[model samples]
Target: MLLLVSLFGCVAAVGAVGTHARLSPEAILPASAESVRAEAVLVSRFGAGEPHLMLLATTSGSVDGQRAATSGRDLTDRLAADPRTAWVRSYWPRHPAGLRTADRHRALILVRFRGDERASRAAGDDVVARYTGRAGPLRVSAAGTFAVLSESDRLSERGLHLAEIVAMPLVLLVLLWTFGSAVAALIPVAVGVLAVVSTTAFLRLLTEVTTVSAFALNITTALGFGLAVDYCLLLVSRFREELAREGSTGPAVRATLRTAGRAVAFSGAIVAVCLCTLFVLPLPLVRSIAYGGVAVVLASVAGVLLVVPALLVLLGERVNRLDVFVRLRPRKRTRSAEGAGAWYRLALWVTRRPAAVAVGVLLLLGLLAAPAALTRFGMYGDRLLPHFSPVARTSQEVRAAFAATVSDRPSVVLLGPGAARSAEAVDGFARRLSRVPGVRRVDTVTGAYRQGRRSALPPGPAERFTVGGATRLSVVPATGPAPQDGLTPEGSRLAARLRAVPAPVPVLVGGAGARLNDVEGVLADRLPPAVGFAASATFVLLLVFTRSLLIPVKALLLNALSLMATFGLLVAVFQEGWPAGVFFGPRGAGVTDVIAPLMFAVAFGLSMDYEMFLLSRIVEEHRRGASTPTAVATGLQHSGRLFTSAAVVFATVTASLALSDLLHLQVVGTGLAVAVLLDCTVIRALLVPALMQLVGRANWWLPGARTKDRGQERKTGRARTP
Candidate 1:
């Protein structure tokens, strides 16, 4: 066993190196979407794509001043000269109003880097490194899709490292306190390390076949560590309990594997199945997370079920060595006396006043969930980064200084054969597009049009629009606050309006705005089926595990309620920015990140994790001839502290993400932390017990299963009571 573990560890260590380099930082849009198609044509035919880098050059005087103009031209020339640049468009020499700030003290330089997404980001990093800071007469700052994403990736990596630094010691402390022995505490940590390492290696290999998000690393580390510890907590605790009962290492190991090992397997499968629901969403970010999450779950389960039992066998009674917290640990109690503990007492109280407890907890959860109704979903932008982030600050400056610019403008690609030859048709379409409400101008192969009139003949390069029988039109949005990658509400409205306009030929509308609409549409179409599938699978799994119909239904309802409350809290904290000083996240962007769906799937799975822990124990007790109330209390006594410790450790791991400057990470961290805490304390502890008590024998009812004998219930009723 030691040799096998060591060999696997060595391979994992080798593979994990430079894993992040193989992962993508770019957002993956659906290829089936028209916008994506247009983008493909634009890149393939026109040698142009969305600007990957934006340089904001600010001057003390008007940007059009001779000195500033010369510097800007020099800056643009320098950018254009770079071999990495595909193209560079600037406000220098000929100042377009949209490219210059209203005060004329700042100008925009848009640059598209050559090559693929990763190469573009690399180019952006190089450009920012070389061109940022003061030039002769201007101060240049960089912000664009690539720049922002690059910064986010850097921050995310750093945040993950920081979280590890913060979470590990805290996890060890929790384990030590829970096990009352440093030796036992280190066992879970070792399992966690093994799981993380193994999953990291799996992700590295996964990247070789398909695109995976760099963000997957974050989830891999957090979930791998957390779930490993959680499963180990169950196994280690069960083994200890069985050790005392069986009075032999081999028997205790066997018993522990029979009970906790089975629960861990079921729990891991459920979590993995839940994460697989992300596959229904046509987004690589979520899909990558699904892949990483499943891998982590499998690795953690394997380590706990295979490696942990081996370690326990080897250590035997020595597992209790290094009793650092022995003084603080409670004395061992008889099975009957164990029911007198805090968790058991609380369970009894909840069962005694089941109706009142149920109603009160439901009310609290409802109130917490109220804010979810107000959630507005939108794609995030540089504003999702810290205010001090260079890209974020540059983006803010651009929005404040300029109105609409080429970067935020939607592009229309006419793709049918002979489309470019239809001059009159193209002219009519361009005029109609310009006439749309909120459209500032339309630049096409023929000329620039404004408000249904031809304003000017093609100014820069007509070849940019007409290439290989395809004609492109750039629809400049009206002057306003910058749309976040053209994915804001206003941007979506504009895209919809433009799409509604009559076209002379088959046209594909493409831009961040059009892409946002496409993405939202896909989610709307796919989300229902995905959710139904996950729910059905979970229900079936629970039913098979518990052999109880009402229990599965109850678990589903409780998980949904907990998730809704968690979403509400996310909306309130991240979107509404309530109690802004607490999380230290960026100011609210007025809408929740589109990542909410992903968060929902993840949190729901994790909530069910704790649910499975509690239910497994309760079912164990009930099958042992305990009455409903006694089973509930005894189950709490057996598994409550174990899962609660697991929740705390998991919460600690995820909550450390709040320290990240990336708002998306902060949202994930804070949301999961709250979800786990609420699940363990309010939902699992109070509500589950209360609801189970109210349901009575129905909680254990299974189809075609004989009801418990009345005489046996009567026989065990008194003996089971605490």
Candidate 2:
């Protein structure tokens, strides 16, 4: 056993060594979407794509002044000269009004890189590092898709390191208090470390075959420590309980594996199943999270089930040594005697007034969930980063300064064998696009148009748009830059309206706004099926485990309610930015991040983990000849502290994510913390007991089974397997 553990540790250590560097920071988008395909054509055929990097050059005087123009020209020349840059467009010399701020003190330079998303990000990083500070008379800062994503990646890595530093010691303290033994407490922490290392190795392997988002590293680490501690807590607690009863090590370990081991396996499988549902969503970010989440869960279960039992066998009664809080420790009691405990008493009280308790709890959950209806969804962007991030600050400055810039506008790509052959048709299409409500101007190969008229000849090289019989039109919006909150409702509507416009050739809309719109549309189409699969799969698993139709149905309903309430709170905290300065530091985009759906899937799985923990014991008690009410009370007595402790520990670990600079991470962390705490407290403590009491023996009903009298089973002292 020791040799096996050592081998596992060594393998994990090797795999984890450079895992962080292997991860990618590219934005999430569906590869097969029309917008993405348009982007590909622009990159491959036109030798230009959407600008991945933007440099804002600010001057104390007018940007048209000699000093500013010279500096700007020099900056543009440097960028254009770089082999990494596919193309560079600048305000200098040409003096396009749209690229210069209204006050004429700032100018924008847009740059596209020569390769894929990863290559673009790497080139953007190098460019930002080289020219972001100052060039001649201008102060330059980087902001754009790749620049912002790169900054977020750096900050996320730093934040995760800091979170681990802050979280681990606190988790250990909580574990010590819960176990009252320094030695036993360290055991779960060890298993948690193993889980994280092993999962990191798994993710490293994944990155070799497919793109894995750097954001997934956060989930991997958080779930690794949280779920490992949870599973080990159950195993260790059960082992100790069995030890006290059997007065021998071998039987105690065996019984622990039989009871708590089954729960661990089921809980892990359920969590993995829930995460796997994300595979149905086409977004790379969501799929990567699913991969990381499933990997960590499986690693955690394996570590706890194998290493923990081996340690228990080796340590025996000595597992209870080093009791740090011996003075505070309560006297050991039998499972039957524990019925007089607080949780058991609470359960009995809830069962006695089942209807009223259920009504009141449901009402409270309803009120908490009300805010979810008000949520507006948007893609995450630079604004979600910390205020101090240069990329975020630059984006804000660009929006405030420039009246219109190419970075925030959508591009229309007309594709065919002779799409650009007719100048009249191209001009007519450009004129109509320019007349759209939100459009400031439409620049095509023929010329530039504004408000249904030809405004000017093309400002830059027309050949850039006319490549291989394909024409690209840049549609600048009248509303300045795109909103900092990402794809706004207005942006989506504009994309739709533009797509509806008549065109002579096959047109594909591509740009930040269009990509976001496409993502939301795809999610809307795919989410229902993914959710249905998750729900049906979870129902089947619960039915098989509990062997009762009503129990599985009840569990599903309760979990859904808990998740709804969680989303409601998230909408309030993140979207509404209510109770400001408490959680997230600033007001959010007045919209929920698109990542919320991913959070929902993960949190639902976690809620079910606790549900299974409690129900497993309840089912065991019911099979052992106890009445419904008695079984509920006894189950609470046996498993209440176990899951509650696990929830608290899990909450503690996730709550540390609040310290992250990324707003999405903060939202995810705070949302999960709130969900777990609310689940263990109001939902599990009050709702489950009350609802089960109202249902009575019907809770355990199964089809095709002989109905036995409870009195007969009690008299015979016979137990049946669920």
Q: Rate the local accuracy (lDDT) of all candidates.
A: 0.84, 0.84
Q: What lDDT tens digits, residue by residue, belong to model 1 across residues 455-572?
A: 8989678788998889999888776454434767677778888899988778889887888787777788988999999999999999888888899899999989998899998888
- Local lDDT at 131 for model 2: 90
Q: Which portions of model 1 miss their true places by more than 4 Å?
A: 30-32, 62-70, 93-98, 102-104, 427-464, 478-485, 500-504, 707-722
Please give, for residues 551-598, the per-residue lDDT of candidate 2 as tens digits.
889988998899889889888887887875775766755777766757
TM for every model, in the order presented, reads: 0.93, 0.93
lDDT of 2 at 170: 83
lDDT of 1 at 704: 72
